[model samples]
Target: MTTYAVQRSLPGITMEQLAAAQAAAIEASKEASEQGSPVTYIRSNFYPADQRCTCLFEADSKESVEKVNRAASIPFDRVEEVLDIPPMQH
Candidate 1:
């Protein structure tokens, strides 16, 4: 499997909502890291209401990363899949 940076955009999402979602994400990351794979989920962007909320996650696949967003119940505009593969890996 390869590493992927999953970018999720949250639309019309407020700071409070983002805060709550972020709390849950932090907890989830702790749990998942303890369980397996040791993934990192990061929340970026200061103004979410005006701009889209961003999250960067390192996971093996898009499906797994999307599952994290869905499980967090965070309202998102879009989820971008960016695979991180190097020539050396091939």
Candidate 2:
């Protein structure tokens, strides 16, 4: 599986709405996996200042990630493959 980033511009979004969107994304990912597409929601970062949200997912292809977001009724600017580098362990 490859890591992908889903970029979204959510202007005027509230905390409650953000939580709901996250939940929807999770559920959508589970449903996709069950259907054999196999997408996993890793994490998300929300920037309140710019009203931007970037969500990370592990999936076979970018289409799989896009499908999940569409199924969840989430609007996104774009979906692209990304490199995920973790910090070195102490």
Candidate 3:
């Protein structure tokens, strides 16, 4: 499975939501992270906003990302899996 970085953006992030989402994210992340299932950081971060919350998920696939969002109940309005760029070796 190829690792994927997923981006989720919302139109307002709350403190309570952050906590909930964090837990949800962790759980979802664990699915791939544990036993070295190609999950890396499972990393998630955000700030209180009057009208938006932007989040990024580094994992294995769009489906995994969706699962995370669904688990978190974070009301994701958009998601984009990052495309890996080949490094140019000198």
Candidate 4:
């Protein structure tokens, strides 16, 4: 699976909306896994002050990531394939 970063901009996003979006994503993920195409929602970082968020996911392609976000009714600015770099040890 490849990592993806999905950028979303919500001017007035709330905790409730975030929870609903998560639920939808979970549902989509389960459905995809059952169909043999697994997509995992790794996590999300919310910037309330900026009214923006970046969600991370693991999937075969960006299209799968977009599909899950769409199924969850989540508005996103774009999706980009990302490479994860480990932190340097002191």
Q: CA lDDT of each candidate?
A: 0.62, 0.98, 0.59, 0.88
The TM-score of predicted model 4 comes to 0.89
- The candidate that achieves the highest TM-score relative to the unseen native structure: 2
Looking at candidate 2, what is the lDDT of residue 41?
98
Candidate 1, RMSD to the unseen true structure: 5.1
| Model 2 root-mean-square deviation | 0.8
Instruction: In candidate 1, list every pair of residues with a backbone clash.
Output: none
Better of 1 and 2 by lDDT: 2
Candidate closer to the true structure by TM-score (higher is better), 2 or 4: 2
TM-score of each: 0.61, 0.97, 0.55, 0.89
TM-score, prediction 2 = 0.97
Per model, how many backbone clashes are there? Answer: 0, 0, 1, 0
Ranking of all candidate structures by their lDDT, best first: 2, 4, 1, 3
Task: Please identify which of the two predictions, 1 or 3, would achieve the higher TM-score against the true structure.
Answer: 1
**Which ranges of candidate 2 are over 4 A from the true structure?**
none
- Can you write out model 3's per-residue Cα lDDT over 17-82, one digit (the tens) per residue? 667777776776676566454444345545445455555566556666666667556676666766
List, residue by residue over 39-87, the lDDT tens digit for candidate 1: 5675455454456556667666666666666667665555666554557
Clashing pairs in 2: none
Q: Which regions of candidate 1 fall more than 4 Å away from where they truly are?
A: 1-12, 48-51, 83-90
Best by lDDT: 2
